[model samples]
Target: MRHRLLALAAGTALLATTACGGQDSPSQEDGELTPLTAGVIPIVDVAPVHLGVEQGIFEAHGIDLTLESSSGGAAIVPGVVSGEFDLGFSNMVSLIIAREQGLPLTTLTNGVTSTGEQGADLGGVFVSGDSDIESAADLESARVAINTLSNIGDTTVRQSVRVAGGDPTGIEFVELPFPDMPAALETGQVDAVWAVEPFGTVIRQAGGREIASNFVDTDPDLSVAAYFTSEQRLAEDPELFASLTAALEESLAYAQDHPDAVREVMTSYTEIDQSVVDALILPRFPSEIDRDSVQTLADLMLEDGVIDAEADLDGLYR
Candidate 1:
C-alpha cells in the first residue's frame, strides 16, 4: 500500500484569496523604519508574528513588517524564491521538500505545534456529519481536499491513513482553499478536508467532525509551521536575520502570555468570527526551531519518496 502512494511530485501552488477577507496590499514606500515583507497564511499559527507587528515589536528592531498572504506552501516558497517576500511562514514538511528540491530555505524560528492538548484543535482531517467515512482506512479510493499538496496537508493525512491500515496512495487530493472547504464538503465536492485552525473550528460549526487528531504528530510534538528565509538573505545580512529572530521570539513570549492581545490582533487579519477566536486553541509558540523535530519531518519525506535525496536537516538552521 505504501508503494502505491502517489509521489508528491504534486502541485505546490497556493490557493487564491477568498471572497470575504484578506490582508492589506503590500506597500512599497516607508520613511523611517526598514520594510520587511513576508509571505504568510492568515491562520492561528501565524498570529504571533502579526501580533508582534501590532505591538511594534518588529519596529523596535528597526523593521516595519508588511504581509503578502498565500493560500498554500507552494505560493510562499515561490514568493521567497522570486524575491517577493523577505521571509515566509509555512510547515516543516514543505520546507524540507523545498530544500531537497534545491530552494535553499533556512528555518529561523518555531511556529506551531500539536501534542493532543485537550481542547486545542490545531488541525485535523474531517468529513461532514452525514458522511459515511468513519476512519482513515475508509478513505481508501476516496477524495480528500487540501490547501496544498505535498506539504503538511498531504504528509500528515498519508501518515495517519497508513497507520490506520489504509492505502494512502489510493486517495486523490483536490486542491481547495481553507475558506472554501466547508462549502465544498456541504455540496459534496470532496469526501474530506485536512484544514488548519481556525478552519477546523469552522468545519465543526458547519456540522463536520474529525477522524483523527495530531495528524501532524510525526514526532513527540509536530512543528506545524515556521518562519523561514532564503540562504542568500542569511549570507548577505546576519544582523537582519538575528534581529528578526530576536524580535519574533519576544513576540512569541508576548503572545503566549497574553491570549487576548493575540486574539485582538488575529481578528484584524483573519476573517474568522470573534466567537471562533474566543474558542480557538492557540498553537504552541516556541522560541527556537527544534532541530530534532525538523529532522523527523525530513526523514519522513525521504522515506515517502517526496524528496529525491536526504536533506541536510542540521544545515536548515543558520
Candidate 2:
C-alpha cells in the first residue's frame, strides 16, 4: 500500500493539468447550491458526516453533499486527485505519504480522533480469549491482520509493542478488511487483528480480548483521519471550500455533543449490528485538526520506511 501510493504521486505530475485542474462543476449562480461529492469509508469514524447530511447542514450552506463509500484511502486519494470526488476522507498516515510524494492535497477539516484512553479507545489490537498472546509484546514475529499495511494500523500497532518493551521490528503485518478481522481472529487465520468500531465492539462481544489500544499508545490525542481535497479543488472554489468547512465543523461538533445521534446515524450507512452500535467506544470528532499528533504520525512513518522524505506540512491544511 505504501509503494502504491508513492507511485500514484510519481505519476500525478502528468495528470495534474487534466485531472486535478478539471472543473467538476460550473460556477455557482446566486441562490444556487453547488453540488459536491466526497469519497469516504463507511465506518463509525464517518458517522458525523452522515449525520450532517441528514440534518441538512450542507444544504443550509448552499451545498448538495453526497457521500460515496470505498474500501480505504487507496481509492479515496485517487478519486479526489482525479476530480472524481470533490473531497475525500482518509487517515493522516496516507495523506502524509501522498503529500510527501508530491500529490497536491490538503486537509479541509478534522475527521475523527483517538479517545486518549488506554483500554477504552474506539480501536485496538484484539486476540481470541484463550490465545496465548497475552499482550502487545507477544505479537513479536506474529502475523497480525490490519485494514491497510504501512498505514495507521501497523504504525500504531508497532508503537504499542515498542511501548510494551517488545521489539516491533520482528512483527509481520497482513492486510485484511476491518469487517473481516473478527472472523479471521476467531478462526485463527491470524494471531490478532487491529480493528476499529463498531467491529471492535463486535469482537469484544464475541469474547475477543483487546490487548492494546493502538491509537492511544501511538498518541493520546491522535488525529486518526480528516476530510481533505486536492490543492486544485481548494484553489478553484474558495467560497465552496469555506462553506463546506463550516458545515463540516458544525457536523463534527454536533456529533461530539450528541452521542446517541452518532450511533443512530451509523446504522444508516453501515451494516454494523444495532447491538454493536450500542456497545461502541466512540472516537472524538473535533472541529480542529491536531497538528502535533499529525507530526507524530509523520515521524513514525519515516522511521518505519513508509516514506523516504519528511512530509512538508506547511501548506497541507486549509
Candidate 3:
C-alpha cells in the first residue's frame, strides 16, 4: 500500500524567492551577526542543536540562532525549502524524497548515525508487556504506529518486516506523535510503534517489549538525521553558513564526549525524563557532511518508490 504526503512545490517556490539571493562576498564583520531561523524536532537525534544552544556555541560564533520546534521531518523540510527557516534538522529519507521532488535544498552538516545496537537505532519498535507478539514475524498482521509515514521510521520498520520473512504489506501503519505512542500502546490502540530516542527508552522502562531493532535488521550505516538549508541561503551567505556549521560541529563533539551535558540541555526542550536520556545510546555525530552516506538513503528511497526518481545528490551538500 502507498501513502501520499503533502506536496512541497508551493512551499519550495516561496523559499526559493525569499531565501535565495545573488551571491555575495563573505561577510567581513565578525561580531555583528544576522539572526538565523532554524527548525528542529525535539528528538535525541538533535542533541547537537540543543547542546549548542545551552553551551552558547552559536553566540560564540556570532550567530543569533532562533529555534522553532517542528512536528517532524515532514514539517521541517518544507520550512527550509520555503525560507521560513534558514536551516533545519531532517532525516536522510525525508531529504532524499524532497530532493527527488526538485526542492533546492542542501545538507549543511551531518546530525547522527545509528549504531545498530539492541537499544539503539531500530530499537524503537515496542509491544505491550503482556502482548503475545514476541518476534518480528508475529507483528505481520498487527497494527504498528510510527511517528510519521514515508520517513525513516516507516522505511526501517518495513525493511525489518521483510528481513523476517513477513509480508510488510500485511501490516497496518498508523501515524501517532512520539509523545502519545506509549499511551497508545498501553491501551492496545496499536500493537507496536517505531519510535526513537527517549520514547523508545521510555516504553522499555515502562515494561513494553521490544520485538526488533532497526539497526540490527536494516542497513547499519544509515544516517538518522542532519542539518539542512536552502541552497540559496548558502550561496548568498557562505560566511553565515560556515559559522553555523562550525558551531554545530563543536556542539556535536561536545555531545559525544559529554552525554550528561546533552541530557541537561535536552531537559530544557523535551519532556523526556532524565533517566531515559541517561539510558539511551546517544547517536554518532559527524562534523562534515558525507555524500556517500546520503546517497545510500536516496538509493533506498528509489528502490522503495518513496521517491519518484533518483536524486542528484552530488551537489546537494553545502
Candidate 4:
C-alpha cells in the first residue's frame, strides 16, 4: 500500500539579497500587536510554531505571527538576512555555512532535534527491505539520494557511513525532492535515501528498511535546525526578540508536552495522510540550543570540506 506523501522540497540554494523588510520596531498599533513574518518550511519540523499561533502563545506576547513557507533553509537564510522575514527556520548546517559566507545571522531558539535512538530516530538512511545493504558501511559504493548535496543531509549521511567504517568518498549523492525520494527508492533508482517523517513513515510502510539514523550518528542531542534572525533585526529590537523568544519557548514546551497537538497541526499546513501523521516519529523541540552538539556538527562540516573556515559559534546565537 503505497501512499503519496507531500512535503515541501528541501532542495536549497542560498542566494545573496540586499533588500530589507519589516519595521524598525514592532508595531504599536492595533492594541500593540506586532506583525511579524517568519520564513519556514512546511514540513513536520515546524509544527510548534503553527501550534503556537493557533494556541495564541504569540498573541499573548503581542505578536501577530505570519508564517511564510519556503523550500528550505536555502531560502529562509537569505530571507532573514535581507529582512524579508523577521525570523526564519532552518537546519543548523545552513546557518553555519551562511555565517561563514559572511551573512550576519543569529539563532533565536532551537527548532528541532534528534530523538537520539540509533534506528528509531525521526529520520534515517533507508533501503529496500529485500536489499543486501544491512548497514551504513554497505553504502560505500551505493548511490544515495539526499534533498540537498552539500548540506546537512549528505553531510550527516557521510558521517554515518564513516562511523560505520565505510569509505564515504565513493558514495554518489543524488539530489531529489523529499516527495520524490520514496518512489525513487521503491523503483531502485537510488540504493538508499535520507528520509525524514512523514516521508520516512511512508517509506517504512511501503517496505523500506532503515539502515542508519544519520542525525543520531552525528550527535545524540543533535540540534538539527533552529529559528534565527539577522543581527540587524535582533539589534533593532532586543525587547521584541525577548518577547518573541519567550513566546517561542512557551510554544516549544507546549508542543513537547502535547504530541497530539503537534500531529494535529501538521495536517493544517501539509497534505500528509492521517495514518502517516499518527505514526510519525516526531523530533524533539527543546527551547535551549545544544551548543556542544552544534559545535560537533560544525567540526564535522569543516572536516568534510563543507565549510571553508571554522564557524564563529559565539556570534551565531542570540
Candidate 5:
C-alpha cells in the first residue's frame, strides 16, 4: 500500500508572531532574548508550545517568539532551510529523511508521542461505520485517502496496513486534506482516510468506524513530532538554541499539568470544538530529543527508499 501521508511560509514585512499574539523583536540582551520564528500546525500535538506562551514561559525566558501556523511539514522544512523560520515542528521521520537528503536540519526538542490509546487524538485511518472494512486487512485493494503523499499520515497508514497482513502496495491512495476526508468518504471519492486530530475525531463523532490507529500499531515511544532548526541557526547562535529548548521545556511542563488551560488558550486559534478538545488524546510531551527513537524512524525511511542515505546521528544532541 502506498501510504499517503498528508500533511509554512514566511515573509517579513513579516514579524513572526508567537501563539501569544505578540510581535518578535531582536534582542540586545546577549543570551537573554532572541527573535525567533517558529512554525506549528494548529493541532493538539502542539498544545505545549501554546501552553508555554499562555503561561508566559517564553516571555519569562526573554525570548521574543513568533509562531506561524503551517499546513504541513512540507512547508515547515523549507522555511527552516531558507532561514525564514528559525525552528519549526517536524516529524522525526521527515526530518531524518530531509537531513539525509542534505537539508541541514537537526532536531532541537522532542514534542509529542502518540500511543494507541491516544491514537484518535493524534490521527488515524477510518472507514465509514457501514463500510465493509472491519479491520486494516480489509483495506487491501481498497481505495484510501491521505492528507498528502510521502508524509507522516501516509507512512503511518502504510505501516498499519502491513502489520495487519495487507500489502500496502495493493491499495489505491488518494490525496486529500483532513477537513475534506469525511465528505470524500461519503461521496465515494475514497473508502477511508488517514488523518489526525479534529478530522479523526469528527469522523468518529459522525459515525465513521476506525479500522486501525497508527499510534496503536506503531510504538508509543516513537517521536511523532519535534522542533527542528538549521545548522546555520545553531552555529550563529548556540545560546539562542538553548533558550528555545528551555522555553519549550517550560511549556511542556505546564501543558502536561494543565491540559484544560492549554485547551482554553487554543480555542482562539483553532476551530476544533471545546468539547472535542476536552476529549482528545493528548500527546506525551518530552522536552529533550530521544536519539534512539528518532533513529528508528530514520531506519524506516531508509527501508522505504524515502532517502538516499542514513542520517548521521552523531552530535545530534546538545
Candidate 6:
C-alpha cells in the first residue's frame, strides 16, 4: 500500500536521538547550494521528488537532496523526529497515525492522488488469475497483503469491503513489501494484494487481476501521499522550508507536464524493468492538499479506531 501504506513506530526504542538544529533559511557556504537528506519509499507516489533530483530540479533551486528509502513512518518518522532526515516522503494516513501516537510532524506538499478516472489503475486489491476471489466481498477470511498495516493499506480495504457488502473484520491483513506481492499472489501466500501505481500495473501484467480499486472505491478523489517534515524542523528552519517547497513543487509540475520523462526517471528509483516502465499507468500528481478528502480520511480512521481523535488538518498543512 505505499501511498496507501503506513509504518508507525512508537515507544522509546524508535525515538530519534537528535533533532535538527535551528536555522533561519536556506544556508550557503561560499555559494554552495545547501544539502539536505530526505527519507523516501521508491514508489510511484515519490517519483516527482526523485525526478526533480534526477533532472536538476532541486539543484536549480540552489539545493541538493539525498533520498534514502524507508517503508513507512516507522523508519521515516524516527529519522524526521530525531533530525536525521530533513524531510520524508510518505502517506497521509501513516503521518496522521504517527501524529496521533505522539510524533510531531508537518506537511510539506501533497504528493499523489487518484487520476479521477474510474478504474484508471491508481490502486487496488488484486488476486492471481486463477484465484477464487472475484469481488471485495470474497476477501472475507482471506489473507491480504499490504506494504504496511493500520494505515492506508488496511483502512482503504476495510472501506471498500464494507462498500462491497462484506464484513472486513474477518479479513486478515499481512505485511508484505510491494516488491514481494506479485510472487506472493502467484504462489498463494496471499489471497489478495493491495498495490498502487507502477506496482499495480506490474502485478496485472503478471496474471494478477483487480478485486477492487481502493482509491476509487474508497474515494474517487483521494489524497494519498505527501512530502513532510517534523513540526520541529519547520519551526527550526523556515527559510530552508520555503526553498525546498518551491523546488519540490517545480519538479512536481515537470513530472505532470512530462509523463514519459517522469516514467524514465522512475526506473532509476524502482527495480521494475524499462519495458514495464514504458507502459505504466501513472497516478495523478496533486499540486496542493485537499482538506475535504483528508477530513473524510480522518473520519474513516476514527470510525475504524486507527486514530483516537480528530486530526487538526488545517494546522498540519497550509
Best by lDDT, which number? Answer: 2
Per-residue CA lDDT of model 1 for 1-318, tens digit only, reads 121112322232222222211222222144356567889888888888888988889988877788778876666876675556778888887777676666667888887767455334588888999999998888888899988766667777887788778878888988788999988988999999887788888888888988866444455477777888877665556666787788888988888888788778888888888888787666778777767776777776777677778787765776
For all predicted structures, in order, the TM-scores are 0.86, 0.94, 0.90, 0.91, 0.86, 0.91
- The 10 consecutive residues of candidate 4 with the worst lDDT sum are 1-10
lDDT of 3 by residue, 286-317 (tens): 67655665666666666667776777876566
Please tell me which predicted candidate would have the highest TM-score against the true structure: 2
Which residue runs does candidate 4 get wrong by more than 4 Å?
Answer: 1-30
lDDT of 6 at 152: 84
Q: Write one digit per residue (lDDT tens) for candidate 6, span 6-79.
A: 23243333334333454334556555677788998877778888888988988877776889998765568667
Ranking by lDDT: 2, 4, 6, 3, 1, 5
lDDT of 4 by residue, 26-140 (tens): 4355567788889998788999999999999999888889999987787677677656788899999888887776677899899999999988888899999889999999999
Q: How does candidate 1 fare on TM-score?
A: 0.86
Following a full C-alpha superposition, what root-mean-square deviation does model 5 have from the true structure?
A: 4.9
Task: Give the Cα lDDT of each candidate.
Answer: 0.74, 0.87, 0.76, 0.85, 0.70, 0.79
Between the candidate structures 3 and 4, which one is better when assessed by lDDT?
4
What local lDDT score does residue 261 receive in model 4, on the 0 to 100 scale? 95
User: What ranges in model 3 sit over 4 Å off?
Assistant: 1-12, 15-27, 289-293
Report how far residue 21 has shifted in candidate 6, in Å.
3.2
TM-score of 2: 0.94
| Model 5 worst lDDT window (10 residues) | 1-10
Off by over 4 Å in 5: 1-33, 116-121, 315-318
lDDT measured at residue 151 in model 5 versus the true structure, 0 to 100: 58
